[model samples]
Target: MEKNKAYFVVILIQLIYTGMFLLSKAAFDVGMSTCIFVFYRQAAGTLILVPFAFITEGKDSSPLTFMTFCKIFGLSLLGITTSLNIHGIALKYTSASLAAAASNCLPAITFFMACLMRFESIKLRTSSGIAKFTGIVICMGGAATMAFFKGPELRLLLHHHLLPSHAQLNVAEGSGSGSIWVKGVFLMLLSVSCWGVWIVLQVYNS
Candidate 1:
């Protein structure tokens, strides 16, 4: 039952992420400003989550020091604010699929950072180390392929027929700019790295 619950949660999380990517891309295609979209997105999350957090944990939460508060503020600025803004811009310039696929590198980036901080280690002589190294290589390769390669598009009647005419036109127009696509990929990777740093910092602080 516990295992089933975990699997269900994982599936739900994936669905949420997929919906976010698709909806954000659709909004950007319709000429929504990335900055404004991010603002609304963050505001909505705060409104929904903050009250629940207060209700659940407020009384039991430990006292926060000024230094701790400063650290939290800085981490939030670096990790959430900057990362989401860049991700929004990247989603605007690139396709939703590319942004979602590129995010697979988060574990690789986080592991590498953890090793640098001595929080984790790799011993090449061990099988688990070898597997970890191999996985990191594969993740990096996948992200690189997404960033640098653009294969021939598959134009199915179903694809075009399902989307509105304007959406179809937007799709065609969105994929035409190679330079901006490259820039967006770079920014997306940077955003992922920032998020990885955030993960590592949270672990370290805890």
Candidate 2:
């Protein structure tokens, strides 16, 4: 019964997420500026949270020191601004399916970053290292497949599509009609890097 319940919850999540994906794509189809979209997201969140943060923390709260502010700014810029800007802009030049397929490599990127940080490691004699390293290689192969391969390659081999994907909308304006797919890839990579740093910082903080 518990297993069935878990499966039902998972299915529900998938259905809701799929609906969200299509809705967002529809928003993009209907025309929205990336900046406006981002602004709305931030402003709406701030509208709700700012008062809460202020009231809960207190009027004389000194949590946001210069260094703390810097960290927040850096995170917002790197993780949010750079990533979302590039992602939205890139989407304008590429297909939603393609972008979604490409972004899935993100987990592997995080795993590799974790290994680099000594949070995780590989040892040859042990099966664990070899297994993880192999998984990493496979993940890279998947990313490369999305980037370079044009056709429905490997579709027959895998039951489900192993392509790239993400949750973003509001394609950016400008750059005057060029292949921004590469730009998308670069932004995704940059976002992954930022996420890697975030994970490292989180580990350190903990």
Candidate 3:
């Protein structure tokens, strides 16, 4: 029963995440600045989290030190602000498809960062770690190829296109060459690094 409940919760979270992503992109599409959108997202989430944090950890928890609160706020700023701002700016300057593709490396990249930080073990002898490492390498190879290659042989997913979404974003309209494309890719790379660092820090914090 507990296992079933856990599985259901995972599925529910995924559905909610999809809904939120669509809503967020729509906000950005409808002439909202990414910073403002991020502000709203963080504000609303913090409001919800406050009660839950208090109810869950109010008792049996060590006294909250000022330093701890500051660190938490700092982590939130880095994770939510820097990450979202870079990603939003990147999306404006590039096709959503490429942005999505690069962003998809997030989970794998975060795990890799955790390993590099020694929060996670990187032993090839261990099947789990090796599996994770393989996934990260594959994601990186795919993303790097998409980012660096300018030749016909490397433009496969480019030609394939992303599945059309409700965002009404016509990724098909992406011009093959432009300065914005370079800027977007670079910004996404920065966002990816920040997100990975944020994940590593959170893991250690927990």
Candidate 4:
């Protein structure tokens, strides 16, 4: 039952991410300002999570030091604020599907960084290590392809149009623009790299 619950939670999280990607892209298509969208998104998250965090962990947690507070502030600025801003801009120039697919690189990049930092070990002679290495290679290659190639267009999932014709056309054109797509891919990859570094840095905080 515990394992089942974990699986359910994972599935739920993926569904939520899918919805976010779709909605965010739709908003961008409809001419929403990426900066304002990111601001509202972050503000909403803070409103939802801060109260719960204060109630559950405030009393038990040690008083934060000035230096520690600075570290956290810097980390949030590097990891969350900058990353999300770049991601939102990238989403403006690329399709949500590409954004979602590129995000899968996060764990791979994190693991590679951890290994480089000596926080994780891998023995390439071992089966598991080889599999991990192979997966990472594939992920990097896929990201490169996404950045450099403008593949054939994919058919829409729904037969009926959900967005206005202009919005749909804008989305399609954005995805197909070689220069803009490359720029978006590079930004997205940079954002993922920053996030991976953030994940690694969390160890020091803990």
Q: Best lDDT goes to which candidate?
A: 1
TM-score of 3: 0.70
Q: Can you write out model 1's per-residue Cα lDDT over 1-206, one digit (the tens) per residue?
A: 88799899978987888889988987887788988998899899999999999999999999999989988998899899999998999987787778878777889999998999999999989999999999999999988887788887666754555434445545565676788888899999888989989999989877
TM-score of each candidate? 0.88, 0.63, 0.70, 0.87
Show model 4 residue runs off by greater than 4 Å: 142-161, 165-176
Ranking by TM-score: 1, 4, 3, 2
Each candidate structure's count of clashing pairs: 0, 6, 0, 0
Q: Give the better candidate number (1 or 4) by TM-score.
A: 1
Candidate 4 local lDDT, 153-204, one digit each (tens): 6668545667554446645675647777878888888889888888998896
Model 4 poorest 10 in a row by lDDT: 163-172
Please give the CA lDDT of all the candidate structures: 0.85, 0.62, 0.73, 0.84
Off by over 4 Å in 3: 59-61, 95-103, 125-129, 141-177
Candidate 2 Cα outliers beyond 4 Å, as residue runs: 1-25, 46-66, 152-178
Ranking by lDDT: 1, 4, 3, 2
Model 1 residue 63 distance off true place after TM-score fit, in angstroms: 2.3
RMSD of each: 2.5, 7.9, 5.9, 2.6
lDDT of 1 at 120: 97
lDDT of 3: 0.73
Model 3 has a clash total of 0
